[model samples]
Target: MSDIYLFYKPFHVLSQFTDERTDEESPRTTLAEYLKVPNIYPAGRLDYDSEGLLLLTDDGELQARITHPEYKLPKTYWVQVEGDITDEALTQLSTGVELKDGRTRPAKARRMDPPKVAERSTPVKPRKGKGTSWLELTIMEGRNRQVRRMTAHVGFPTLRLIRYAIGSWTLEGLKPGRWRQTTVHMPEQTQKVTLKPRKKGRGEHAGSKTTHKAHPKTAQPKSAHRTPRKPKGGR
Candidate 1:
């Protein structure tokens, strides 16, 4: 089976194996320090500011399967926005958004009323006379800060972003800086085939002759504490 890891990366930690700017006064934490296994790389990158389930694997084929755009794995996010989300904004997000880069794919977005989300340690700045709202969005693409950009485009700037799930894997029970290993059933092309046992060679018999012999007996050594010929000699 291929080796795959699910890491719950904390906010402000770089996703790279090593920090390029290690000379700085405060170097960023990286995945290499947390994961000791060798030859594994991240399937895709999560922005340093975002926190959630991040995938790593030693199998390049599995990595390609997950990160390649053609596979189209869905990523679910729990987002907090600056203002109350309108039905129009939800519709726009579901339909599509025309960003400067290009039009994004249609997404699944909905307002989460009475959101059952964890409170952030660092609260976002509250605008005057404006209330915040929560939303759950699932998208197929992994663009840079796409969730935040999309929300901002819809006139509701995202204040906090947390990814909850990726494909069938979720970040349940994983705390910040903690990780877990999970197995994914890859496509047939990626699975390894077991070879059948070869037939016995010529002159090899099913039942081979065997012999057994009784073991030879040996004299036991006397203990050092035993007196030798005590009766024959006087002290």
Candidate 2:
């Protein structure tokens, strides 16, 4: 079974487990500081500057689906931008704005109140006594810094970005650096594709479909008589 988790990643923390560049004087925080579970890795990336909901799982297939751009999972963000978000900007954002890479897909964008949640360590404030605005933006595709670039292109650069939701999962009841264990049920078709009948051997249980790999160095004993190969389309 896949061990899935919803983690609330805080600001300035890396999505990965280890920080190879860390030292006693200047330490970098990582997921290893929060998550103690073994074999569980982050399914998708949350930038070091960005904060909010992060998905982690041991299932490779589930991780692939969530991270792949082709899947088009809707990610909702509560963004604090430099200036007031106008209706015109929202319209352009919803219609699809041209980016350096290409035109972005039509997204759901609307002006919203500041989200009531845990504050960042390096707090985002209005600069030069200028007013700032909060917005709710949802996008399907995951481009590198797409949210920040989109808001900037629309004339209101983002001050702070918080990913509020990914698909149906939200950051409700989760504080910064906190995580919750959960099960994500896959489709029947996916289940069939993920699980294959395990070959029974000495001291092995029948009908088990474990995903563990065998040692490369440890080889099986060869028989004098050739054994018949099983036909394709596993039983």
User: Candidate 1: worst 10 consecutive residues by lDDT?
Assistant: 226-235
Clashing pairs in 2: none
Models 1 onward score TM values of: 0.74, 0.78
Q: Which ten contiguous residues of candidate 2 have the minimum total lDDT?
A: 226-235
Per-residue lDDT value at 39 in model 2: 76
List, residue by residue over 1-235, the lDDT tens digit for candidate 1.
3556767777777777776674888877777667776677777888877777787777665566667787677899888898889999999999989988888899999878644545455667768988888899999997778898999999999887888887756666566666665443323332222212122212222122212111111112213342211111100
Question: Per-residue alpha-carbon lDDT of model 2 for 89-136, expressed as tens digits?
Answer: 999999899999999999999999888987789978877967899999
Which parts of model 1 are misplaced by more than 4 Å?
A: 113-121, 187-235
